[model samples]
Target: MRENEGGQERPGGEVEEPFGFWRGGGAHERVATGFEETPFGEVWERFLESVDTTNVGALTIGYWGADYDTHFVYPVPLLVEAAASFPNLRSIFLGDIEAGQSEISWINHGDITPLLEAFPALERLKVRGADGLVLEPVKHESLRVLRFESGGLPAGVVRAVAGSDLPKLADLGLWLGDEAYGGDSAVDDLAPILSGERLPSLRHLALDDSQFQDEIAEAVASAPVVARLATLSLAMGTLTDRGAEALLSGQPLTHLRKLDLSYHYLSEPMMARVCAALPGVEVDLDDQQEPDEGEFYVEVAE
Candidate 1:
């Protein structure tokens, strides 16, 4: 719907009222209900209303691939306003941003600070490819699930998550991409996550693309409160069979039922060896991949 306000086109085109809906009010009021030259703020308010209806207990929104431009054309402030209004919102998933521009050029921006502060009941947050996903002061206690992908959990992010008073959190996912880049030390950087008695209620840990070098194995192996963890994912990393073996060796992850090691280089025998070490645990080694011998200086098992 194209709106011509004094012969000027609106940013989101024009608004057309749904003709089929019955309106009890006068024509002007009825038309105003649906037809308005919506500014970015109005668009965000409408978005909040659409998602907040029915008082739904949980709402999950995902933005992936090149589609980010479509959902993020609005200014950051408006988006923050929209996010804060969703009282019942639980999970937020984000992935692959082709055009990374909004409130901040990076994925970890300070704009999301207000939303985290306002939503006290927020539960799950999964962010991937959001370059500007900076740390925000968290006030939500009902939060349970947290996941990150394609980016390292920076110091600010780890500090924020660790400092949160989320007593109900269970699932924690962190994927810090390949280790060759500055990500090799990511595991060590997340020391606060495993330090002391933090994340007491955390039960499941999913780590994909993040290399947990041997340096932090002790921290991961000795995580005091993650004993109840039932599932673990260690996909796409420099994690050797040794690291996997080390991570599960004499660890509190005795409750692990599912383990995914896809895209990592591991032979059937090494995989079998790891599985034998953790009897009863199902290990997924179906998609094991290794760099070509010419490209890789290290010996790779088939």
Candidate 2:
């Protein structure tokens, strides 16, 4: 979120850089690791040698390593090193590998606090995986877009984010996943952001990939942030009639530009209702799923 909320000049003598899915949307530096074809030590050596670190603004890391255990051992140190070296780096997406390297849910992680401390200029950071994840209550001023896609987002990580005071944060996304993989955050635990007191600057909120999608949806329907948000994503969940019904009956979300409800379990009738309710909004109802063995299922459970 380097750009101003309205796409003006960013504060702090900077310009907005492309990030996340839009990583290469602007002038970005791309670096990838051949974990399968090369040794980790060699990969690090090459990464160290191949970048215009001083002038780099956006960096997208590809395929840190393979499997559940190996990913934990490679990137953190290298990223910490980059944090010190990549002075101009504004955006970083760690663990940008596909399911073949390691599924988003199964990817193992370690402490990421050092990277946060290292890169003072970082305006946006997106990470995959939540297992063994670690984050301290952030006190960053530049970070605006922070997203984590995971199978199971731990409670501590959620609480860490809750207590964080990211004054410039405009987009905050948390994948509060299933409890079986340590997605232990309850609806009550997310009181700060859901209450919209923590992130006063947020304009986009994604509380997704959970067993309690309906509960979260119920909360978000009345959340103060909804009045100001540009996009609201509750994708990759078991969002059904109950949750959709809440949105239909709740305060008018007429101000929103996009409503993402991808990977859901909604009946066609209920989906029809949501579409009818928010006629002008771009409602994403793609990948509608069915229950497994008569029980409703979350899309990304590990």
Question: Pick by lDDT: which candidate is best?
Answer: 2
Candidate 2: segments with Cα more than 4 A from true spot: 1-18, 21-27, 35-37, 66-72
Question: TM per model?
Answer: 0.66, 0.86
- Local distance difference test scores for all models: 0.49, 0.77
Return the top candidate by TM-score: 2
lDDT, candidate 1, 1-302, per-residue tens: 11111222223884322212212122111001111233334454565555433244443322221223333332334435555454455544433222322211233333455655656666655554434456664656777777655444444565566666666777776655433322333555566566535667775665555545343444567766446666666655555666666666746554677676666666667877777766777676666657576342111111
lDDT string, candidate 2, 114-204, tens digits: 8888887788898888768898887888888898878889898998898988888998888877888878889887888877777889877
User: Candidate 1, 122: how far from true, in Å?
Assistant: 1.3
